[model samples]
Structures are given as structure tokens and as C-alpha cells.
Target: MFLPDAAATALLADALATTQPDLAVVHLHGDLGAGKSTLARAWLRALGVSGPVRSPTYTLVERYPLASGGEALHLDLYRIGDAGELEFLGLDDADARLWLVEWPERGLGALPVPDLEVHLGVEGDGRSCRLAFRGVAGESWLAALDERRRLRMLPEPSP
Candidate 1:
């Protein structure tokens, strides 16, 4: 879909926030300045992640414990030199209910398959977002999102 601005992007992210299940892997795909991080921050914030939501660029991974009782893992593999480096991130030990990963292509065969992939791209003065589902959880999440959007229960995106 075409997101007219950052606020529009945030609205989409918020809608997604309410539809996610207990366990989900989301891959955010986009080039630099494409608003990938903005969408991620908005999604995390909607999930009740208070405080600073810094980009995981340098740190590689950042964990946020949701007040709702689940955890969210935000990972940025932009600087990763090798897929083996992901091993130190200890993905196997991850107990996060939601995983948002950027630069997933860098992790390739090492990363877990994403339940849903949110692909963003620059389009004119705005951004374009495409949602693709992988597993059953993703299908369910998309169904919920469609229902919510269809019901017009979701808040309108800020201009």
C-alpha cells in the first residue's frame, strides 16, 4: 500500500501491532531512509515500549520487555560481516514473542524464517509498504488486520 507520509506509515504499524500473536517473526525490508526503522519504532511503541527506542544499528540487537508480558527483539544486521556473527546474538536462547529484523538478507540461512515480511520502499514523497505472510501465524495476523481495517476501527493515519 502507499503510505503518504511518516504518520501514515505509523498508522499501518499500529494496525499491525494489534494483530500480532504471542509468537511472530517480522522482517522489515527497505533501503536506507525508506522508513523501515520508523515503522519498527512505531510498532514497538504501540506495544507499550516506553522510553527510548534507539536503532539497533551498532548494537546489532536490542531487547524490550513488553508490559503486556511478552518480549520484543529488534535486530539490525546492516553491519554484520558474516552470518556466523549472528551466533553470538544467541537467537537460540531468544524468548522474545516478537522479532523485528532489519537487513535480514545479511543473515540469510542463519536467521529464522519470518512469519510476516513488511517490505517498504520510497515512492515519490511517501513510502510504499507490501505485506507478505509466511506461516499460519502470519495468515491469522493478516486476517485480523484486514478485519480491523475493514471495520474502520483502526485509527486514521495522521496527515
Candidate 2:
């Protein structure tokens, strides 16, 4: 499935809000400037976060406390030179948290299995994304996520 830049972000944000406020994770696979960070920001906002959301290309991860409940960690592994570095970031939060990880492949063997995977790409004048569910509980998100995709990947309107 795919989405227009804004709608995709909104869709993802809405989907994240349905995860029951516990530990959830999204592993995003995308190229540079393909709206990965935009989606993260939108999702975080939906989680009731109000602050500057920036890429953690250097810090590896940034934790934001949600007003609704729980914490969300946005992580970017682009600058990471090795997989071993993931251990130092301490991604496992015993208190339960939601993780948004980009360049997930870079961390490979070190990360846990994601409940959902968001794969995006730069397509023409906009962006496209695909969401794959890895667990049964993710079906709700998957359904809503696909509903958004149906429109984005729909036929261009009378162009």
C-alpha cells in the first residue's frame, strides 16, 4: 500500500493511537527524505506529544513522554557505523514504551521483532509506503493502515 505524504503520516499516527498504550514498535525502512521522520512526528503528536521532533541521527534515539500515557522513542540508525552500538542505546525500556525506528536494517541483529513494519520510498513528486503486520494484534492497525493505502494508491483523479 501507499500514501500521499500528509495522508500517510496522518494514517500512521491514527494507527499508533490504537495500540492500547503499551509496548509497541514500528520498524521503518526507507530512503533519505522519504517522509520517515514526518510520519514519526505525526505519530508522536497523535500520542499527545507537543515538542520539536527531530531525527536522532547522532544520538541514535530520543525519548518523548506522552501526555496520554507511556513514552515514545524515535530512533534513527543512519549514522551508526556498527550493529554493536545498539546495545549502548539501551532500547529495551523495562517500563514499557513505544519505539519508532528508522534504518532498522542497520541495527539488524540487535533489535527485537517489530509488531509492524513501515517501508517507504520516494515516488515521483511524493512518497509511497507499505505496512506489513507481523502479529495478530496488529490487524486493527493493518486494516486502517490499508484503508489509507487504498486511496493513495488509487487511480489519479481525472488527470
In order of appearance, the predictions have TM-scores of 0.91, 0.81
User: What local distance difference test score does each model get?
Assistant: 0.86, 0.74
lDDT of 1 by residue, 1-159 (tens): 778777776777788888887888999999998888898999999899999999999999989999877689999999999889999987788779899999999998998789999899997888877889888888888788787773244333355
Q: Write one digit per residue (lDDT tens) for candidate 2, span 1-159.
A: 455558656765666565532567789898898888888888888777886887787788998987756678888999998889887887665343788899999988887778888888887666777777777646765665556563343334223
Error of 1 at 28 (Å): 0.8
Q: How many backbone clashes does candidate 1 have?
A: 0
lDDT of 2: 0.74
Per model, how many backbone clashes are there? 0, 0
| Pairs of colliding residues, candidate 1 | none
What's model 1's TM-score? 0.91
State the local distance difference test value for candidate 1: 0.86
